[model samples]
Target: MKKPLPAAIAGAVLAYCALATPTALAQPEAASAMEEMIITAIREDRKSRGATGLDLSVYETPQSLSIINAQTMQDFGLTNINTLLKMATGVNVDPTETDRTTYSARGFDITSMHIDGVGMPFGNLIVGDIDTVIYENVEIIRGSNGLITGLGNPSGTINYVRKRPTNALASSIKLTGGSWDNQRAEVDVSVPLTESGSWAARAVLAYQDADGWLDHYSNNRQVAYVVVDGQLTDTVTLAAGYTHQDNNSDGVLWGAVPALYNDGTAIDYNVSTSTAMDWTYWDTQSDELFAELGWQISDHWLLTTSARQIDYQDNSEIFYVYANTGVGLDAATGLGLLGYPGKYADERDSLVLDASLSGRFNAWGQQHQLQFGVSSARSESEGLSYAAQSGFDVMPPFPGWNGREVPRPAFAAPIVSAEQDIDLDRIYGSLLLALTDNLNLILGASAVDYTNDGVSYGVPTSASEDGTNPYIGFTWEVLDGLNAYGSYSDIYQPQYVLGEDLNPLGSAEGKSYELGLKKAFANNTLLTLALFRTEQSNLEEFKAYGDGDGIDDTDYSDDFDYSLYRGIDVESEGVEIELAGQITGELRLQAGYTHLSLEDENGDEARTFIPRNTLKLLMTWQPQALPKLAMGLSTRWQDDIYFDSAYGRIQQDNYVVVGGYASYAITEGLSVSLNVDNAFDEEYFSSVKYEQVYYAAPRSVNVSASWAF
Candidate 1:
């Protein structure tokens, strides 16, 4: 019999959760409405400057963009970015580890993450899912971003806008419990430090714990955030904030299930089967602080400066499984999977700084906008490794095994595993020319100096680059509420792969071109259509795998994660269509579709591991007659993806995942919500790069109560 999915939550502080409010599912908006939204309904306002320092609207940004505000997140119970991004258009959330995720867009790996228009740098090979409670909204920019983001990555950029302190008193608490013993609690409070409201502070804290669908797996998370904002004088504003987070997962998979047998036949393991031993675990902790200064030099001019620092640490003791012989993996007996264990720890510190001056000036009898800025991002990573105890390899489940069959391995003396530094410094500026009342042109460029020094995992991680990249765009108001735009930008990404001469290769360089159209309708609605193409060379392609000594590297040919890289040029072209905003007084909607094609210099298809088509849709309805209730549904669909590896052909056919939610207001200050993910329980693989793959999670449900005051 299936176990009951119910639980009692502790701490019932009755603050309003703000659950039933009919906040418009606001999408990205243009720059014409920033001022009025400064202090009211800020979460519902569409203000995204993450693409360029200059303030611009989503339709005016000249790129494919998407935005999901706090209300949308709360409505859907999207407390984490992994689940949040899944409902976004043109994005692929690729899960490589149970606790980590990699995002890709436009057929390229995303390399940049930003908070409040500042770059956040991390050089780790492993990245965990980020909590979203500290953010007010999330903006996704799809395409090459080289103008201000120093790094010319074509995959796109993810920008998180932190929740600022509110001038008025407000408080909310939400408690949730559901399937697999999942439980969560969050508290938020904002208060004016001064009665005049010139000074304010806000704090938010969250905790979560849950068992897993995978046997022997359990996890817990904790997060805290504190922020203060104040108007020191009539024209000066200052803000400072701090955030801390911890994630721990036990009985985790160091390696996933083997997809194929030694005999080359597909092996289907039980959905609940986990290769992790009872003693294995992975954990990460992070803390960050930031400060910002804004000076209103004049009515139309402003100066802003910000600094941020983050300290991160991760520790893990993992066990790896592999085939014992040529025909070792026999699914029938499960005798072929052998285990190898390792212990690792990494401490990473990153800092980012930015200063910009922006203002409006009259040029040619017209008002024009411009911004100039300098920014730098630095990350240093150091790690320690311990030798594992002997005989640990023979302890995994074999003939008649259970999770506890093997004892925890003893570690030998710790040794330095890595010492590395990655830094990027940039000087950039942009100008918005008012060609006419209905026409505008934007010109921007950045001069960047990037360097990577030291070694990681015995490989020399040395690279230095200095160059200038340009960006240009044009937008025209074709009709009363429509816009047409075109954009071009340069792309750059450093490489660590060795060349034929055993030296590092040059950076991958490319160009991106995009043209699009957007329409704005009543009820805060937006529609967008875009066509884009990008081309690049020096993208490390597969080379021979050997000892991995920068010479004859010893590795698998299709090990995308560690495969040897050789310079290769590739091109990708795609089309995207999207819509966001209220469809009617009773309905709010957001949806998008993308079609992409990628090819190598040889005209052969490239990166077959990435799908060519994807679509996402989400909608909410609240009838005026039934003002106390609201409901929503979301869907994600993708084309098939396949990759050939040492283990054989790995393919995932096209599939769709659906989710639903509903909320009811019990009172003006209280509400409750029910959320169901993977509603149809569709079985599908979330990734296929490695021999061991992961199946998407099964259907899960959650119910929550929230109070807002």
Candidate 2:
């Protein structure tokens, strides 16, 4: 039986407070220092890039924003970007494949990503696999940011900030062990290269090997990162870094097992069940090199230049099942027929360059700021695929489907299956004008040009498009610590699908409207309320024939004319409320609630897999008496979701998940921590589609110890 939500929340809060109050009251001096440290951990003091590409405060930004700091990441043991995103406000994860995960905000799929303000391509796949150890913080903007991103989705954008080298020597090492034979070790070190602190270097390394709850599944990973910073002169600085990551997994599932039998009857399976064969495997590797240069031209003017190159590769072999209405397991043997055995390999490379100049001046007795920048990016991808010559004929039928009975099959020579290239160029500018002491206006625009060229199975295709987007916003100080703001931003994206005329679908365009109120308390806490709407027209939708007999559907290997598009108009609207920062000297909290609605031109709900109502709450407490101990708790809830499946429409019920963590300091430089996830062991589906459903992970425990010097 599940615990009642309200009762569970109340019990946890009361217990935590009871454990912290007495100890805190006994020691006032230690409590004062702890309060200051807690406040610093939860709040950011440095200026950061906002919607207008200017350094701004969270209370002054016109768009909805959320920042997750390094302290919170460590408290929850968030090792990857996927784990970090699960706790963010108004964000939902959609796991399409075992290795691919996508995020959605406000009913729209989020596709834009940045690292230090530079754009990154193929974010959906990269973000899920990247480790979080190298990042200092993550910033999310929950509305359109097309002025800076150029061509992008209207959903939102994510920016990852890396940790920089410190002039002083610092080092930390950690070891972890957890449920399911999981083991991990990591090390981080920073050192000063010069006595005057003019040069510095930093390095990070991590390794992990884990066994999954599912039978025959296991994972192995390794990562290495290094960075160097040099003060070349009094007014110039240079920084460079390199990162490499490799991951390998055995018994990776291509898709989930069938949800229903042939007669539309549900099939019950344990959460630990898997359909993958023992020989199935997936591997990925990535390498990146980046450099940045900064120059202080004058007191009010500065220039920055940056460049990056990335190489990524993926290889996989898997067995597939094409379950349909008539497919069913054998009654006598409980065995099902196999569909196909496939082998795949893919490689991608990207190069990006950016330069920007910002300055401030006085005009008409008022101060103003302006920034201008230009950016160019190019990406290329290639892939090869091979399948068993006899398809299902050479594959053995599943025997009870335990993932260990099937034998590997022979495959034919791989053929060049896919090749693609994309290039983007943009120039953008923004201006901030101070109309009055309490009123500020932001204006920005960008001109973008993009091209896509590809070849597949001896066929060639290409497309080119250009567009201009504008942004306007204002923030008014309504009171001493409260502000009112509104913004309108435009978006454009080139579609890759072909239309009825055999040419590529035209570019999709959209606009976002946002209005919000923000308040900053003297106690270092922030509260925000936001209302937003986004609309897109000329969106592409695929049209397939009932039988694979149409010309557009017959040529499966060609890149062009593979699908006919019917126009689509989509609208997504939502309201969000958030609170974050220190609530008291020894307590820190972050909470958010969101309500969303989405529809298409025909008034039909779109992206039905995403929930309409979601809530998240996280809190941490430190006791003065037990000054060496810190405790944390978090809760997440989501409303019911309805989506269509092959059998029929399926409605998933609402669910709640709880997590807790505690850390104890053994000495000045040594600490130990324990983390428990899904404490109530809630049962639910993490992702669903017409043909497959993935079950959520059950309860798990992890414990780690760290030492710093």
Candidate 3:
């Protein structure tokens, strides 16, 4: 096994400590007025996802949490959720195909998502396609969040907060142009509807058209959002909002090209190589409506209720490739005889309702905070698929292939291949007790009811399960500005697969243990170090037999009673360290390092896509001599990973990517910015599977101008 920490990361740690130690030891009284003002600004920026729920600071929270504010998003040019996940600590983005992306944390894929603290399910091909322009900030909680997210994975939870209406009139407009014929425009405006400023409204619009580096690949996207906020009475408030998004893409690849030839020789292709036909396309449309009501019962008591409805649709026509070891593409002719052309259409509808009451009270001569909430979510989806009878095409392949020359194939009529309905209801309660001025205890529990009904390929199945999860933690003030904490949490997720007896498989369960230390400095900087371990059991594994007699020779589906069993067990252990906030009045920084080890029952490494060692750093500086100009740098480094393939084991070497950005305030209300990614132009594979591989983007640059009023 390779060493977990490399020399490059060690050097970075030394540099960070040298730069931060002096400021960390400085006295608050010795700071200048400008420094004090900057500290205040940092404090304001630290407030997150507090209005709806989980109103706690990073230093005060027992679990690991990271926040990416709007300012960081603009500085780094993180326009989409995928880019944001790449920058977040301990998170990995795995690209399965051109239109499908999955996120993993702590060796497990993340399935729990929330908008403004309301639970939302994330799945299918459209999960990563959501635009980030409408969000004010994003919060990532890394651990078992079952106490709040009920019937979810142990990997973690993601919460997005929407940009709300401003009390005062504000507006902004931006125009951008980048490499690959990328052009984008955005407009945001907020106004006070009433003279007294009791009512307000806001609107945001954005559009983008971009051409990819690969041959015959392009995309267009549009988004529109509007919201209204009103203070109905002296102690009551209401908000309503709607969002719509449409995305269309041409020449989307279903799978990457073959990695090896028929003669057992590795094939090397250019970075812009593509295997998609010009006629292939994928399109998605989504619409959402939400409303919230809040009542301030007293100075320390509040009640909130929220509801959301979503409708999503996806339509696609794709040409997929499958390359077997001994029958790969011909080396001399540059042609392959394996292809599958298909058409699919899917639609989903979802509705969610949530209500909570939170308050603080005096009990047993101590201060305590308590919260209770109930939520219900329902979703239904239907899909149709069509495929060619004999999926084989004669066309130029590999080095000399052009998508335009391949003729489109004919497909049969569409059939209902899959339909599903899922419903979940949960009730949860939490209490924070201040045992003393220096000691605190947290207690939480959730009861969840889940049901799933689905039909796949003419096979019908249904499952219903109920479970309760519990959580406990303690935080002690070790020093004047430092805290020590530990927590224990568990999660449960129902499985829909059936066993040989045709009964639903047992549910999967997991437990997490975490301990950490957090420190807050006078400059508003936060430092955190944590150790964690998660154990999962009752994972589903499938097995096939011949004639229902447990023989392995027969390969016919009709003769076999293929079934799933709950026997797999997985464990992941790791350490994480993070430092964030303003290091100085002119400099702002965010840096994180993570080390993970994942293993299954056989003690073999699991989840190869998740690197064992990862580091992420971002820094911004505004020189005193050039107050009107700001510059920043960001970098990410990860360890090597390997996956099993038909030919052999495939290994991807470790790599480091660096990016930079600069912005100049030309005038009071106008500014210009430039961003450059992959400054070193290092080539690496973004994703790799047994049959396909996706390459990362090359060097790219973008320039933008914005005006605010």
Candidate 4:
């Protein structure tokens, strides 16, 4: 009676009946005529999409998914989306300026960003419309999805998927350049409207520019997208979309400016030194609209309805100058010379609502699958600031020009006015139980309601707030490949504005756990190993104020309970080793690894600045290779990090990055490509500061051409 789970997937399909003969015989019997050889291996394994013995079965899906198709972002030339989200594996991407990019997983620190699956919470100007040449894949789900969505952010979740309209009539065009003077151009098109194609449409466009390496900085970008799909009467199916993104930058680059010399000695400079300071500036914008309706209530119940709308905006201004001679005149005569200034202004807005329902069931007899959802979000933010302290010739030798100020906006008081408004509502429900077919069981739960309304003008009056959160997880398939999962999520934040004006900052919480193992081999390879733990609670600290007359306001520190993190993750999760289906035929290969163990546990060692070891590898080769020409190679690595967690110091050191691409086809329509990135420039330090340090991105090259009519 307890053994019913599709008869344990029919007794593990008769005890792996000899590896199920490669999905029940992947077509053999060609008679002695022999000549059927088509190989194009592109299986950098992320769950090799296209299935095969289910990669050795036992996929309890408690979330740990990955898919980065689109021909591996056009064979590793990867355009944006923060360089293809660093190819998954606990994703990282903390650019912090030059259009600010932030996302950290497994150890938390991710602020929701979803497209084609809803949810895009402002900032960085919507990443220039997220083109990536129309995206046909890019799905990643790490852990803790609170039962299907409802106030998310468990350090995992990203789904891009767009790129519809197939049935022939494809198009593509791309061009790129790298290193300090980067440049880019992209365009993609897909068509099929009737002609028995069931209607379809797709479009993408992009433009980019860069001349940055700090020191006055520079960057400009633009993106656009359009999608359309239709079936209408055929059990109803319709999708529509629109998106536009823009970004402009000129400031924000605080890297390198401290080799000691504040009595601590050691200050002679020249490590390939660089500087040319300048007044700062940055601007951003974003827009999006979407709609989808898919109903196929029969064949196992399936219904989906989605709607979305978004708009975001940003503006920033910065300035830095302190060269009154040697170590900036010993910190401006110890600050009595008064010659440093700061200014900033920001605004944000958001609104979202989503609904979903999914199915596949058997109920009482076991074998089941279910997904239910509901979501809502509203946000608003505003901030304004100013700081001054003139004299000493207003310190402006060569920093984006602009000097002359002897009006201490209230005696160099700095920061003024801060505002916040937020309203959230989430409700989720999940179910996935096979309880036998080799043991599959996943349960979900979620309920969240949060609110915050704040203000600060001359200080005080940080009013209104609310909270609620709940979560749970499970997934078991303990053998035949092996799998074990766990989850416990929680979050509640309220600290008002970003920087300055403190004391009204409290309410922060988190808890997480994980364990795993997966293996498959027989030519088509894959391996996985994982262990994780996390803890965080109410940590809001900042204090500064004195009769010493330097004026910087805001202070608080006494609410710290936990802040611990631990990690270990490795994957190569095997299969066909490479070239996916070899242009519809088959062969593949891939690899990955990461290990980060950090600790703070209230002892306050000043929080170890992220990164504790990471490595990734990929390889693909399409057989039947010579005639049409196609090739690919990708490799990434990172280790040695600590960019100031309060005084921990040391930024992006130990590194390795290799990229490859090649394509050729002079007929049919037209095509040509060649790409290489970070071939080996390695100088490290993406960011770090006790005062400054930022550098990353040295080797790169690109060439592309395409056409189809």
Which candidate tops TM-score?
A: 1
TM-score list, all predictions: 0.90, 0.88, 0.88, 0.29
Candidate 2, position 98, lDDT: 59
Q: Rate the local accuracy (lDDT) of all candidates.
A: 0.76, 0.73, 0.74, 0.51
Instruction: Tell me which residue pairs clash in candidate 2.
Output: none
What digit string (tens of lDDT, one per residue) describes model 1 on residues 96-192?
Answer: 6687677888888777788777776442134555789878989899887887587677778888888877757999999999999999999999997
- Rank candidates by TM-score, best first: 1, 2, 3, 4
Least accurate 10 contiguous residues by lDDT in model 4: 35-44
Give the count of colliding residue pairs in each prediction. 15, 0, 0, 32
Q: What are the per-residue Cα lDDT tens digits for candidate 2 across 361-469?
A: 7897887778888888877888788756543532244334666555687888988776778788999988889898889999999898888887644445468889988
Indicate the worst ten consecutive residues by lDDT in candidate 3. 13-22
Q: What are the candidates' C-alpha RMSDs? A: 8.1, 10.7, 10.1, 23.2
Model 1, CA-based lDDT: 0.76
Worst 10 residues of 2 by lDDT: 14-23
Report the C-alpha displacement of residue 304, candidate 2, in angstroms.
Answer: 0.8
